[model samples]
Target: MVFQCQRDSWARQFTTQVVSCCPAELQTEVSGKKATLQGFHVILEDTILFPEGGGQPDDRGFISDIPVLRVTRQGPDALHFVQKPLEPGSEVQLTVDWDRRFDHMQHETQLFIPGQHLITAIADQMFGFKTTSWELGRQRSTIELDTPTMTAEQVVALEQSVNKKIQERIPVVVTEFSAGDPEAETVRSRGLPDDHTGPIRTINIEGIDANMCCGTHVSNLSDLQVIKLLGTEKGKKNKTNLIFLAGNRVLKTLERCHGTEKALTSLLKCGAEEHVEAVKRLQNSMKLLHKNNLSLLRDLAVMTAQSFKSNQPFPPHRKDGDSEFMNIIANEIGTEETLMFLSTGDEKAAGLFLLAGPSAMVETMGPRVAELLEGKGAGKRDRYQGKATRMSKRAEVQALLREFTSHQSTEE
Candidate 1:
């Protein structure tokens, strides 16, 4: 079904009569103005909202105090989706989210003016690149160059030229061209639709370029304010996607970069300009510290092994003088296979490593210790390693090792 079209320009709010209200089809993901169709919708006789079209997003605001989720075109009518549907034939307020609309407008203008002109001046007209397509968004815009890659100098030159044009403050002019007009040959787009008749909208940036477009545009070049080329990347079919930021987005990018600089400066304990050097120094210091720590742990392991060789109690464990306390050490001590556990936070719980010297001892004792400690591990030749939850079973571990050693001595 087609709805009658009404003539309206860019506006923020309006008092419009509701034409119809209906339930959204169940789970039908349809998009009219390129925006997802969602929720219940109401069609208004006249609306201030711009239906998502011409590569710009739909307006967001309230209709009779019910916040519209999204606005999209259904034939010639603008369908406003909302949680609460309005009654047909009722008068309601239609408003646009000014900030969001402005953002989309700026994005659209960027592509129409500086974005298109820059690519034409650089890739094709000058450097011989066949143009493909371009896309614009809230945060960034990407223009595809015909070939997959561009030279570093070309990218730099393109960015510089575009920014220069934006700063020139060239006037933007929008005009209508009648069908079969001589100027129609100048259109960058392939001729208008077959059904297209009457006058076509043409946007002209004074002395820069002109193209047929139906999107909202800025009246002046100064409205764009700033244009920043972020970088270039490979896109579909070896096309070079040049990314950039325009208008308020440039300022937003600066804000985020400043925040990142401040964080880096504070984390590295250095001035903003010296953050890189400070980070390097920190990395070097960490490497040195790691080396020293490993040396200490190795020395401790050897000393701990010596204590086991002698009749000494294990480190970090209670040695009751009244009883014959035993030392159960796991380390490379004169070929005696034992599981060497590295200490973590809790000395009473599982240590870091469950290392042993011999495959037989580790294979037999690994699962036994794991079962007693309610943990698990794997055994290799001459070594077994894993964590144990039965950390408090230090005495049990010591008794098991002692019994194994006694039996070994008898067998020998």
Candidate 2:
């Protein structure tokens, strides 16, 4: 069944009777979070809302006072999912979301038609690249050309050629033919779907290109406003995906870029042109400062180790440091017979721990300390190290080390 939307893309409202209504669920996003919408899949006798197909999203609108969440095509039927169910035989008014519909038309017709046509033509004629595939994304679209790589000069040329065609204001013509008609073979298409039984529709960009498509389109190339090629990305084996924006999308992208430029200028305390240089200088300065800080920490570790009492259990705790710093102090002290437990970080939060002593004693006490500190660790020889969350239990760890060392000394 050809939907009223497919027949008249400009239609905003239609009077239709509900053919069937069944409980259904729609997965959608609210704010930035995923949500499941409980609704009724209502099939109307006829509708002005376009169902999701051909890389385009479904239309959002309302059936009477009930909000229509989504529309999807089930074979020949256009199913309208709504929050509230209408009686199967009841008559209802279907209203399309015009703003959203027009935006989609701009993206679909303006971008898809000219973008696909011009890119494919230019790549084939100039670079001998063949069109492999294309995707119509909500924000941007990509046309993959069968090429290993694309140069900057080639991208600029493609953008310029597309915009030039838009300026020409070429008339876009839509023609339909019966499925089995010999005239259908004259149109350029990948191929008709196996289940495609409707009349074959083709969009002709007056004297430029012709291709079979089922989605709605603009009547003229001028409606596209402008095309912006956002450069190209490496796609699957031997393919280059050329990404682009058209119509209002180009304007929106420029607006976002300008806003970002202003924000960067203010944060960097520099003009827009100098933002890159300023950020580079700032990064270099940070690297130097970080290098100096590490040197000072190593020096402090050496001094603390020199004051260590020999042949005793020493538990050194600090406010802020890391595993490397703890290891530095242990290395300086020389853990031959001295049992040392080194920890650094906030008492209220998380920290690092290093236990060093005789291999036998370290193996025995490592598990005990790890369990108390609420952390796991492994060690070989005479050292054990890992991260711990319960740094607040420092006092308990100190006691455990002290008792174990004292008992060993008594037996010795």
Candidate number of the best TM-score: 2
lDDT of 2: 0.81
Which ranges in model 1 have alpha carbons more than 4 Å from their true place?
1-10, 25-38, 112-123, 130-138, 174-186, 190-202, 212-214, 259-271, 298-412
Per-residue lDDT tens digits of candidate 2, residues 170-268? 887878888789988987777866666667887778767787776767778788888888999999997899898888888888999999999998899
lDDT of 1: 0.65
Give all candidates' CA lDDT scores: 0.65, 0.81
RMSD of each: 7.8, 3.2
Note the residue pairs that clash in candidate 2. none
Q: After superposition, how far is residue 306 of candidate 2 from its true place, in Å?
A: 3.3
Which model scores highest in lDDT? 2
Tens digits of lDDT, candidate 1, 1-412? 1111112335667887988988883233445344444468788877777776555677788997899877787565678878786788898877778777667766666564323543454445557776566776556887777776787888788777767777788777777767778877776664454545457777777776677766666777677787777788989987788787878888888999999998887777788989878878889999999777666666655666687667653344422210111113353353353434332333466543354556676677777766766667676775555656656776677677778767877997
For candidate 1, report its TM-score: 0.67
